[model samples]
Target chain A: MAYIPSMDLVPGVLKGDTRAVARLLSRAENGNEEGRPALEEIFKRAGRAHVVGITGVPGSGKSTLVAKLTAAIRASGRKVAIIAVDPSSPYSGGSILGDRIRMGELVGDKGVYVRSMATRGALGGLARGTLEAVDIVDAAGYDMVLIETVGVGQDEVDVARASHTTVVVSAPGLGDDIQAIKAGVLEIADIHVVSKCDKPDADRTISDLKNMLVLSLGLQPHVPAPLDVGARKAARWQVPVVPTSSVNDKGIEELLKEIDRHGRSLKESGEIVERQAAIAERRLVKASEEMLRDKLEERRGELSVLLKELAARRVSPHYAARKLLTESGFGGDK
Target chain B: MSVAQTKADRIRVIVAKVGLDGHDRGVKIVARTLRDAGMDVIYTGLHRTPEEVVEAAVQEDADVIGISILSGAHMTVFPKLLKLLKARGADDIKVMGGGVIPDEDVVKLKKMGVAEILLQDTPPAAIVDSVRRIVAERGAR
Candidate 1:
């Protein structure tokens, strides 16, 4: 039997012990009975690495894009950690596990570490325990972390909550995708990608993005978009609309440059710190909610009786909940 | 918590998606089947680094860790996971996986610390059986 440490492994990680780092991360994602105390220690040491979240439709060549991005980032001499999220069985709470096959080659590279996680019935479109996973990578000494979300729905904006930069990918000939994103999806993007630029319509997609950016920024169409107009100005619209073809490897370098530039902008604009603070705050609230949810479930038998009474019209759920809260010694007050 | 569990007894497994490729239908089915078979399955949801999956294995005290990879990243994800298992002192945990893998690579995966690789289109029962053998060999209580 392997010697299992009963203590948090953060100190070992800080000392550059990869094994300890890995062990702590595993514990974190398990949400094991011991996870919280372990994470509390690692959490204080996090925030050293840059986190990037990439999301797009399934057929949008996300894996290819990630492959190319990994190569580019690796070429720049940075160690990269990628967290790929795949679909999971809602019933069994496990994954179908296909993402790894697409990213095979990059896996062999010394500087790159790739991990796949199933979206195990987590609300908000991310896998449960993802932050803990990111903490593992961050603590593992990787300079950059890439989070890839399964592009099932628009709710993937949750990535933005954890990452310092959010990349939303779309392909040409996605006919109404641009229009679809306008409603709510596009707003979360720090950068937008027109993938598969080898196609003829890719340029038009880029133009459409420029137009959309102008409109969203509340600028006139005739007014050159901020990035284009300020191409020479010291101050510029940090956001860049990029065209990339993971197939031909076109525009990938430019895309990386844009991503790096945007990272700088996020820092220059003071958004990175603000966003990280918000993410941390959201994480605390989520942790508290999960803890509370477990507590409530522990009293499920009592709650069910109250719910049944409410259902029978003997009392309102709100009133009953309020009463329960009172009995539990909570005021339900702000 | 019986010493000898029925066929319906919960077989605890950790199903994880490894790498940046995001397809996961197969892993989900296996998790569901194993659960329906009365196994306790802990799913380390997406974007998990390999370390996270192994950590989950130890924490769940799982008898097995099932890795599903379709992103072509299996070469790195699996070997690293095994290495970490050994490094973190978890060589005893049975490691298995399946998903869009070529036969040649499956052989390679199995040689590299994976006890079994459940291929795409594999019958769900085969996966369950593989888990059963692995669990039995480990004398999982």
Candidate 2:
């Protein structure tokens, strides 16, 4: 069969066609220019699904928990989709997308769609076009969209910003340097999931996370914008540390309840609007940066003369950059 | 995108084992070898139904499906897989397999739309080269 053009598949995608959704995601990961318009159309239809991001240290049992969570979510009669990511070999550029190994439970369940993605050289624990992949699933009318990123350390916080609610999972033995993880990763969690709670020594990890949350709560002050003061008038949200034994299927239902509650709270507090704006700003900045990079690539030939000057130190790096931006109609100031 | 990945040379392959085969070592080896050759491989661990494997390939948009069966179900597995692929409008995603099959079954398998059948004795490098070739052929199609 000849491949279907992306634009021609837009209606299928909008109609929740699995094949179309899958095809579009592949194109996005490949960074195909032909898929751009289809993605644009698909993204405009997004924003209905609650985008939850799951990130934690490797071996934190992220994939297992995601599998359990998706199953529980389905039992509640909600259609859920998972974008599970695993790392690509830095050497081979190929990856063993083994999240499917753990997610095997969700297979053949029509209500739950799972797509295992290779990080494909995209960093920060996500695959290239991760957000776009989320949007594609979201546009397909999945009630809940879960993005499980490659296990991340302190600085891989991009998933937090890209998602409406971020769940940071940590196994009992993973976080030895609590302070280092706290400084970067802990604060990003809307919910802290202590997975592998069935194992011994789980109590200490739970207590430690709760203590960290309590300790951090008082130190970070909320700066309400003029418009946000009204939204902030709602009761301040507390980050909950939920411990779960995904292996035992214990606490799975309770965690789902908490997620539901959090969703309602976001809307009732009118903070969903604020979150939407912040997310929009982030997306705008990211998309603009993406465009700039593409433009830079296109103008590489034009940049050779400037590159020679740069190599000779005749023109400062800042001057050449500003000149190029201005000449490219980006309105960079002189 | 990560600067490490070379565009235009990557392929996504799903390496699966269907039926009651607990022997996954061979499939895992094939998966790893393909990965080393710079093809993304999704390993559908032991004992998947034909439904699960076909759905996986379509959902992952894989360029090829490599099934390793040691349970003597190649006759049933390959035809069913190809049928499901055709039914889902995904026969474009080529299918191949290998296992303890008699030589006669290999010829019949190929005649029934199975792209390539690797015997157990095939070299690891040959396995990678064949998959790479299959993916390139799909691209040309």
Candidate 3:
């Protein structure tokens, strides 16, 4: 062993010790290698800042839009952190992480921090490491965190869910009415932006999105899904939509102002606390699930034996399932 | 153990993207390759502010930080990443970069703390080697 230290350095992160935050993020992103244990430490010190998620179809200029917004936010004198989530190629297990390329101009600003994350096959469309990445930035004292997801479809929704406010970006004439109508994006956007106004169809796309939002909002509630506990707390409010373009630098500032407005609204209305609570509740559940998952993986050999025994009629399938679940902590009352 | 002990044992590296480049294939590939090679690679993905990447480097206790860029944004992104890295006590981390860097800019990047600039077509082995050598030189310090 090379004598790597434990992840206890996370406490220093809150004090603005950049070294400690970096080590913790490294552990969190790299599955904690020598620093993996820092995750729990990092999580405990998290929850102090606002998180914003940005997603859009590919080439909708999501990254460019984010760049301008973050830069504007920084100029206003707040520390900003960006997490660019890109799709990992199934075949190569690689991601281009090209989103950061759009915001290159902001790369050197002391008030800004940007990180690229591969989705790493996490089912939720966001990278499993993303939550920890956000936490690291949050604990390190960033006033705002912006997460940009590599847009494909529904997975982008999963990425945006982690943010306090989520912006869905779209471009005119790219996918047109069909994309605008997709169930994935319309439902999740707290705000929608029609990017690339320099193009001719930009205004038309904005019109189409507005029309679609009207139709969808009017007909929705059939699902009656429990309101996102946070959404329920902020009841009577609808997410907003705006337009932007990186090419001409249009509407970028307004988009950020909207985010700030939404943040304040949630706070003034007492929904901010509720939203944080909801986020905490969900994160705990996820942590437990991950813990259980690890246990099952650890017991793979015994699980196989149990399965073999069940197949040979040595035990009932139901009993085997129970035993396996119990051994994996699903049986615990706690 | 003391902070010095941690620094000695762990070699931190940051892999970042600089400027209006939305193509991250090279960044991801390099981050994973570096991680598997047993160094801590902190990747700041997409449209990162240069300040953010440098902050990550200093905070992560990186020994060698690499930037991946493809957009013409290199002019803006690289200078910023370098300037902030120097200001934040991260000048110690041997800086290197890759992407569609112009031949003319390579000289400037190296002069500005980028000890190495891997061309777009640089072999993975070379990247791994450059990082390893950088770490080996600085690891025991």
Off by over 4 Å in 1: A6-8, A15-19, A219-236, A323-334, B1-90, B93-126, B129-141
State the displacement of the C-alpha of residue A92, model 1, in Å, after optimal TM-score superposition: 2.4
Q: Candidate 3 versus the native: TM-score?
A: 0.72
Using TM-score as the yardstick, the better of models 1 and 2 is 2
* TM score of chain A per candidate: 0.86, 0.89, 0.84
Which candidate model has the greater DockQ, 1 or 2?
A: 2
Write the residue-wise lDDT of candidate 1 on A141-161 in tens digits: 888888888874554567777
lDDT of 3 by residue, A1-334 (tens): 1334645576677776656665566566555446656766767877878899888777778788888898889878899988887665454444445565466567557677777666655555576567888988898899999988777564445654577887888888875444644576656777888888888888787877787767766666544534364235324456566877777778888888888888888788777776677667756766676556556656766777887898899999788867888777678433
Off by over 4 Å in 3: A1-8, A33-45, A89-94, A176-181, A226-235, A300-323, A332-334, B1-141
Each model's C-alpha lDDT? 0.70, 0.83, 0.69
Greater-lDDT candidate between 1 and 2? 2
- Interface RMS deviation of candidate 3: 10.5
Best of the candidates, TM-score: 2
Q: By DockQ, who's the top model here?
A: 2
Instruction: Look at candidate 1 and tell me the lDDT of residue A11.
Output: 72
TM-score of each: 0.73, 0.90, 0.72
Give stretches of model 2 more than 4 Å off.
A175-179, A222-235, A294-334, B1-9
Ranking by TM-score: 2, 1, 3
Model 1 residue A294 CA deviation (Å) reads 2.2
What's the C-alpha lDDT at position B42 in model 3? 57
In model 2, residue pairs whose N, Cα or C atoms come closer than 3 Å (at least 3 residues apart or on different chains), thus clashing, are A121-B2
